[model samples]
Target: MRIVVLAGGIGGARFLRGLKRAVPDADITVIGNTGDDIHLFGLKVCPDLDTVMYTLGGGIDEEQGWGRADETFHLKEELAAYGVGPDWFGLGDRDFATHIVRTQMLGAGFPLSAVTEALCDRWQPGVRLIPMTDDRVETHVAVTLPDSGSAAGSGERKAVHFQEYWVRLRASVPAEAVVPVGAEQAKPAPGVLEAIAEADVILFPPSNPVVSVGTILAVPGVREAIADAGVPVIGLSPIVGDAPVRGMADKVLAAVGVESTAQAVAEHYGSGLLDGWLVDTVDAGCVERVEAAGIRCRAVPLMMTDTDAAARMAREALTLAEEVRAV
Candidate 1:
């Protein structure tokens, strides 16, 4: 089967690793979340895309879940010594190579999609990794700054790139609004719509809802394509229990007024788009509520502590999809 997965950063990337192992023979296409792309030090850094690439390419820092393994930070130190630093986000020497290459390619009039494809060629992430759009759709969060913050002119809310809101401020500021600045005009990249149209299954990994998957779906054609894809669309819950597995999902979730719970997340997506939902065994009680919402729901161990566990989670999601089809 051909599977298309909507993904975020580390959590999403790790899930894909297991999904790949679980469905070894399936044709997998990963639609990476590029919302975390930020311009820093004259380089474009796509955190989610890089995480997915590194994790699957077997060059990821296993613990951090992002950047290159066995990385050094001499370049970062030099930049610091030069008094040019946003030292909050750790960009190691080896990892800096990716940002440098991506920035160089982007400056040469290549869209992000093409640059991503070129980078993937070397990583060979074992899947067709496609950007949702070649068009720039940098996700930004509006938040209260520590001092006087100038507004982005998008609206009254002061805006910062997604990464700055996430990595630098650590989501401590109140987010008034989240916007994918250019998604409204974005066109899906080559093979993106086609892959969705031809996909037999689409999986939503445990990613941040409002910013990660939400940002990708915010691209005009992407969400509509999946809703009309005429295939099973399954989702794995990022909100296991009442908290996020990683990242500052709770803060963002609250910004949107959605309770950070499995039930609340499923309801947020709603039956309008999702066809199947999977939760952890601890949340088995919520199965009925999800099913009552007209989407199929099942309970299984949802923690992805290791590859074996993640693969099992993937298998369970696929199994639930089959069950949903049967029903």
Candidate 2:
């Protein structure tokens, strides 16, 4: 099978590990979310791409599900001591090397797609990983700054980088708006359209919809390519029981005016783009609601407790894709 997956960070990376184990012989291509890409310490950091690469390359921190395993933070500490701030975002010493290399390659006039391919050369992440766009697209969140003892206290609203809202503020405040800056002008990466055109099955993993998968779709021509591909596009619910399985997906989902429910998410993607949707067993009652919207809905276990569990989810997703195809 020619499988194409739109992937975000931790959840997407972990699910890819499962997808690989589920269909070892399948040709897989990952279109990683670059909306999370940011420049820090004068080095370009592609968080989502690096997460998928590191996880699949067997160098991911298993416990955290991101960053390098056996990672140390001497470099971070040194930077902190020197008053180089933004200490909230932790970049380990080992992980710093990746940003340095990526920034160097990017400075050398290599497009992000080429830079990503070059980085994956060392990791050999199995699947062909490509950025959603070669051009810069950063996810920014509009949030209210914390109240200080002043008249303008809570009235202050500012747009911060997605990482700051996610890592620093920890999604404590509500997100008023989520914007994919530059996405409107960004063109799909070189292979993105071709991969979608050639895909037998396309998947939306249990990544954050608004910022991760949604951001990828924001790139010009990418969503249209998938919708017009004439193949099964299956998605597994990130919301198990009206709440996200991990992370603060609800916060961003609210920003987009989509309810954080399995059925709601399926509806958010809509029947046009998604042919099939999978919900956890606990959400079986909503299957009819999703199916009513013209999407083929199925209830199954959706948790990825381990690689084996993720493999089962992948198989179920593939099975659903087949069912959609049969229809």
Candidate 3:
């Protein structure tokens, strides 16, 4: 199968590992979310891209679900010693080398998609990982600051880098608005729309629907291409048992007025964008409601607790797609 998946950071990367194991012969393409991309210490960091690369490249710390295994903090500690800190997110020495190369290439006038290709040449992430767009789009969260700076949503909106809101504040405060800066003008990166057009199947992994997959669709021609593609487009639920299986998804889900529930999440994407929907067994009761909305719905174990579990989920998705095509 020529499979294309829209993905976020950790969750997306991990799911891809299982996907690879499930369909070793399939040509997999990942359209990764770059909204979390940020400039830190004068280097451009592509968290989702690196996460997917490391995980598939077999260099990832299986337990941490991110960064390299046997990673050291020497570079971080040295930066902290010099009073250069935002020490909240750990950018290891080895991981730092990736950003350094990417930053240099970008500085030399290469767009992010090209720089990412250059980086991928080394890791060979197995699946072809294309960024949502070549444009510089950054996801920003609007948060209120306290008078004493304790924590309060300012009546006036202030935008902070997504990493500051996620890794630093840890999504403690409500996000009034989430914006993908520059998305309005961004064209889909070279191969993005083409991959969608040619793919036999398209998937929305257990990624943050509002940010990760949503940001990718926000780019011009991306959603339209998928909609126009004559193939199965399926989505796996990120919300399980009325809560996110992982991450602060509820906070961001609410920013888009989506209730944190399996049914609501499927409804949020709507029948227009998805051909099939997979919700956890715990949410099977909502299957009828989802099918009523014009999507082929199935209740299954959607959690990716391990590689085997994720592979099972991938098999279920394939089965659903085949069933839909047969009908």
Top lDDT hit: 2
Model 1 C-alpha lDDT per residue in residues 141-227, reported as the tens digit of each score: 888665456444433347888888888888877777788899899888888899999998999999999998998898888999999
In candidate 1, stretches whose alpha carbon ends up further than 4 angstroms from where it belongs are 146-157
Error in Å for residue 152 of model 3:
7.4
Which of 2 and 3 is the better model by lDDT? Answer: 2
**Candidate order, lDDT descending:** 2, 3, 1
Clashing pairs in 1: none
TM-score, prediction 3: 0.96
Q: What are the per-residue Cα lDDT tens digits for candidate 2 across 1-327?
A: 999999999999999999999999999999999998989999999999999999999999999988999999999999999999889988999999999999999899999999999999999999999999999899999999866776654568999999999999999989999999999999999999999999999999999999999999999899999999999999999999999999999999999999999999999999989999999999999999999999999999999999999999999999999998998
Candidate 1, which ten residues in sequence have the lowest lDDT sum? Answer: 147-156
- 291, model 3: CA deviation in Å? 0.6
User: Which pairs clash in the backbone of model 2?
Assistant: none
Write model 3 residue lDDT over 1-327, tens digit each, in one string.
899999998889888888888899999999999988988899999998999999889888888888889899899999999999788988998999999999999999998888888889999989998899989898988887555654444354589888888899899888878899898998888899999999999999889998888889889899999988989999999999999999988888888899999889889888889999999999999999999999999999988889889888988888898877787
Better of 2 and 3 by TM-score: 2
Clashing pairs in 3: 144-152, 144-153, 144-154
